[model samples]
Target: MRFDLFHTRVDAHIRKAQEYLQAANLARIEHQIAADHHLALASMYAQRVTWLEQELSESVSRFSPPFRGVMTVAAEGGKRGAESVVSLQRSAPVSNG
Candidate 1:
């Protein structure tokens, strides 16, 4: 189904976004100013935002049950992982602040 394809794309992008976001956060904490990390983060986010917005634009269409469940789980896991990293980063002290 078309929705399945879109869901799969979204899941793929989400996974990549999660990875890049993690790396960006790590680089930020490590004081790496290579800028590539920031660029990667921005690219990942752009892909994710585009995919999500497209999905939202077709919100009236329903996804298959299994695909819907998978997407939900994937998104939730991504959010939890990102949040954990963010929390850790916040609690970490700045050596040069």
Candidate 2:
């Protein structure tokens, strides 16, 4: 490939990387939201936990093979944080306002 063409391809890859990063951030946000929902549910949190799992699974599914591995790892970490938040919320009842 010509130098310019090669550089263009590289640029495209960079943009894809950025998009992946954005998706990863969004996944993290989704996890946080689910955690909040779970906390709000407290004793009735099983459904919310399932919802969180679905959100994470969907986000994980949306990833392309090239990106899935990294996204999966990052998403796992985010999900853990979310679960922790839910646990804390359950431990102490709090108004959802």
Best by lDDT: 2
Give candidate 2's error at residue 79 in angstroms: 37
Write down the TM-score for model 2: 0.36
lDDT of each: 0.66, 0.72
Residue pairs in steric clash, candidate 1? none
**Among all windows of ten consecutive residues in candidate 2, which has the lowest summed lDDT?**
80-89
TM per candidate comes to 0.29, 0.36
lDDT of 1: 0.66
Displacement of residue 52 (Cα, Å) in model 2 is 27
Off by over 4 Å in 1: 1-33, 61-97
lDDT of 2 by residue, 30-77 (tens): 999999887878856777788988897788788655355556656667
Q: In model 1, which range of ten residues has the least summed lDDT?
A: 80-89
Off by over 4 Å in 2: 1-8, 43-97
Per-candidate RMSD, Å: 31.9, 25.3
